[model samples]
Target: MTVISTGVYPIDKLLNGGIEKDIITSFYGPAASGKTNIAIISSYNISRTGKKVIYIDTEGGFSFERLKQISKEDFDNVMKNILIYKPVSFLEQRKSIFLAYDYIKNNSNSIGLLVIDSISMLYRLEKGDEDVNEVNTELARQLQVFSEINRKYNIPVIVTNQVYSLLDQRDKIGIVGGDLIKYWSKCLIELKVYENGVREAILKRHRYLPEGLSIKFKIINDGIIEYKE
Candidate 1:
């Protein structure tokens, strides 16, 4: 598939027919803004097609309950196609990414998507003790591997990032990796909680699409839908 639906109609349309193949798409946001939810739905969307989805979970964000809610009848089959890895530390995270690459390289035709939900969780934790520059460089190296996989195997990579309050800019929030993440991600979307518990996805950067395009949606139990109210 050239592109895979996020399983949310408005989001799919906003993304010009869903997340594109052979590129890295990033969804960054504050807590409870649907980043992980989108990741889960996207994995299911691809796995349902009989393709393998390599999901590297750094924040313990993968929920069996939620996957069951989304997959429903095909839960067993879809679950089998999704290979999930939960890395406890930054080093473990790097190892997991390498393992994912190896699996994809060996089973190139079967892999559909690679997701690192909250990719920066362990990075953030280690930043304080380790040299900031080294941490950033390691992050860059990890992303470079993903980029190579995209070009080599032609599978989509989706990663989630946490936000931090910008220093001296209280009202603003910036993604964890900032420019590095933006530079690597071919498509970038910012998720934000909007009025009455709805969420908005703002297209920050894309190769063809104009920036600042957005859509509003709500996260329901089964999946997400365009908000009507």
Candidate 2:
């Protein structure tokens, strides 16, 4: 299976070379934990290889300025290859996935990665009005569609998730989608911000990687970089 590098050395090492193709890799963390940076860097790196990337932004967090900072002279070319979708609501997000899947089906040879920046944002917003079971079922169905796309097209899917602190379990954080995400994701990574602005990525679960393995990295103006010291 082909793997796409995240464009960060230590992160790629933690992922056992790189993110495996045809699987869903999830990153969950609080604000400023480097989730978006990883997604952007990965998209930029994959696009650099002359392949197209499908980026779905649920939180309005897609930053062209940041992309320009990372891609430098290749900004325009990279943007050309990336087909971005900004879904304003939960329904739109689902529709966007279907549209992306269809696009990939037609252009499988050219598409390399599928990125959903903050997959759970819209879900969280709509959760209060919907039944819990109904929400979960819909979420499962959406993820299943993504899995099918990955398995059939051999495209790597990267999704970012929000984290919430549990009152009883102060030290252990819970991901927004709860157990469903944990069960469906092929690889799960947890990001944490430490003292002195240090950022760390913990490889919580993977098909091949040993649990509890981690790596340290920093988000700079250019992109994600391994810690110097």
**Most lDDT-accurate candidate:** 1
Residue 143, candidate 1: alpha-carbon lDDT: 97
Worst 10 residues of 1 by lDDT: 1-10
lDDT by candidate, in order shown: 0.92, 0.90
Q: What is the lDDT of candidate 1?
A: 0.92
Which parts of model 2 are misplaced by more than 4 Å?
none
lDDT, residue 43, model 2: 93
lDDT of 1 by residue, 26-91 (tens): 999999999999999999988999999999999999999999999999999999999999999999
How far off is residue 194 in model 1, in Å? Answer: 2.2
Per-residue lDDT over 7-120 for candidate 2, one digit per residue giving the tens place of the 0 to 100 score: 877789888789999889999999999888889989999998999999999998889999999999999989989999999988899899999989988999999899999889
Every candidate's CA RMSD: 1.2, 1.0
For each predicted model, how many residue pairs clash, with residues at least 3 apart or on different chains? 0, 0
